[model samples]
Target: MGRVLLAAVAFAGVAGTGNGLMGQDVPLAADFPEVYRVGGFDAPEWAEFAVPPDVRFDAAGRLYAMEGFLGSGSVVVIDTDGTLVRAVGRPGEGPGEINRPTGFAVWRDGRLAIADMGHRAYQIFGPDGEFERFVRAGSVSDPLGGAGSMGSKLRPDPAGLSLIAQGPPSGVGALTDLFGELLGAEAPGEERVDDRGLERLDLRGEAVSREPILEGWRPSTAGAEPPELSLDDLTEPAGMLTMMMSGQRWFEPGFLWDVLPDGGIAYSDSTAYEIKVTDGAGRAIRRLSRDLHPEPVTRRIREEVRERRLRDLEEGSDLGAGFRAGSGGNEIPAGIREATTEAMRTQIEDREFHDVIPVLTALRATWDGAVWVERVGEEPWVEFGPIDVMRADGEYVGTFAPGATRMPDAFGPDGLVAFVELDELDIPSVVVRRLPVKVR
Candidate 1:
């Protein structure tokens, strides 16, 4: 379940149903008859952190968690038994220290690489947790100079090369407008373009090749504002109402696209439950599909899910007081207090939910050359089990049970690396369990 990296790349076309990839429509109860259950590792009560966003495992099965935020961040290294071994890195501009770690990866040579967006560099660490060297990720001044944004996912390849999933550089106008937005200035009628794709970068910080994958939505806060309304007259009230609009207004849900080990790309269109895989030449060789029905998002279902989500947020973690209670603990003035409550109520009553949920939510290409299509479970929260598996030759191999394992953040020689958030405290813990040898 880690960022599933598939093996080998082939560009041979296949006929529709005759291709044998047309998956069978089977009930979940009957599909997963035998389950491959595995136990999870829980963090010790003594170890705690403000936030842990990323989890990864090196060749020796050692688990690492990127804990804390921008300035207060540190990498917590753990043993196989979930015991806190030690912490690495901190807020600093020095060699090993990192201001903000956005993404991380384990190189083929057993080197742990962490991308620090604050410093615009990737700090390389040896297996023993020692700082090796640093590589410039990219430059903000030069949009297309190197790897691009801080959000790029780093993947390891042969010959000291890495593949990064990032968008192309912004135009001069877009950069100008973006800077204006950061400075709280209005730059109306300016166009902003975000070209989504993949880039292959050499060890010397050079983008050797680029592959166009899909077009995605830019952040709403990126210079341009949403369409104006009567409420636009008084921005505060209008702004609260407008912000509550769930989902994207301009762009569709993005596809779960990733690059295969041998340089092929495998992705699923957001609108349908079909996987379009291509080889190094970028030719469509096969389309993997399943017998799935997009579940209807009825009014009742929508309301129920919304209620559950809100309850989880209120009870789960330490969200801002503004979100938990409308009054903001009486620290706000009466005028702003009334406006906030009214805006929230209006958003709940006026918001519209989609008619149907997408059949598949994510697509991952595993190390064994199998594609795991994550289906939208009947329950609202992210579900673990019943993942659909497809073979290398575009053939459905039935669903596999995830058991106690959460969605994997990374994979290693031992097994999948998953993170489980404890209740109430919302403490993060890492678990590495070996998958059953036989796929039931």
Candidate 2:
């Protein structure tokens, strides 16, 4: 049995730093140690998972572990202590089958909602792992063709609705870069444009309402240099000769905002660390922030990140080569292949690092209604990074560490569920770690 913890601890006086913000900078009362761990090197005789990227806990605390990519994976259910209970659904295009399973939302009625990438739908499944029905997700025209509009995060409401972010295809320019550039054709960017924002969907998958959330085009970057290729870069023959360029608005407050339990909004913007909580009418109700500053991305930091990037590329290339050797090489045209490789190489070798990191990298609201804000550490990739826990009323709790034993993917009433991946084989197993009562 996993240890159940007090959702929050009492702390002394701490003041909010910014104007219109409610939370104070409540530092930890003591060191946050791991109280329990559920997954490890040991595997159950019944199951072996590959690349389980998403994990969720249902109302009953049964863990749902999704392994493999969106279009090809299985959802494995396990007990709180990492015992394999059953595996549900396989990769396919049929009913009950999921091609790409990206996100999960637990319905108030105790059913599971899955955001399927391949099917362009939120496939609902019963607690018994039986296929219910597909709530169809909307699609948009990408440069590659039609693409799903649902983002990865899914939040369920008590009113029989699920909240999700909707955006254009992340890689909308890929096909345009290849085909349009090769033929020197100019394409307008209008059709690919989308009103990126929060979308509310009912159980049957009908979108009840859509709220525009993102503000202006303030791009935020950290380690990677600006991408050289724009949609126009490849299409304009001259741009092919020149370096291509691209940028992404920091995913912090804009697309990263969460729908609050009370049907409100809690989102951060690019200019500040504060989160503006808004009611349904888009009126600001409260704001949340802490007295923390972003770490500067110095030259040394850039070099270290560069090394990591290069190593990752090398490993990926090796994996690609190995796959090609086994399944025969890709049948891409030589001209396009050469051009794409050179373009990626140039960008990787010359990306400029942002001087300061984003204050908040990511945030999620727990079943207990506590907002978990992932602070950007000095070393972004370090294990056991600190996460600040804030109550629904915007009171700051202590920072908790998800160390090597617990890399949490989803949080529930009992604790957090992490996909403990085996280092050597990359096989994934589920872990549930109970939260500590006090930070210490």
Pairs that collide in candidate 1 are 4-365
User: Candidate 2 — worst ten consecutive residues by lDDT sum?
Assistant: 1-10
Model 2, residue 422: distance off in Å is 3.1
lDDT of each: 0.52, 0.54
Best by TM-score: 2
Steric collisions counted per model? 1, 12
Residues 392-414, model 1: lDDT tens digits: 46666556444423345555444
Error of 2 at 316 (Å): 3.8
How well does each candidate superpose onto the true structure, as a TM-score?
0.67, 0.70
Error of model 2, residue 179, in angstroms: 10
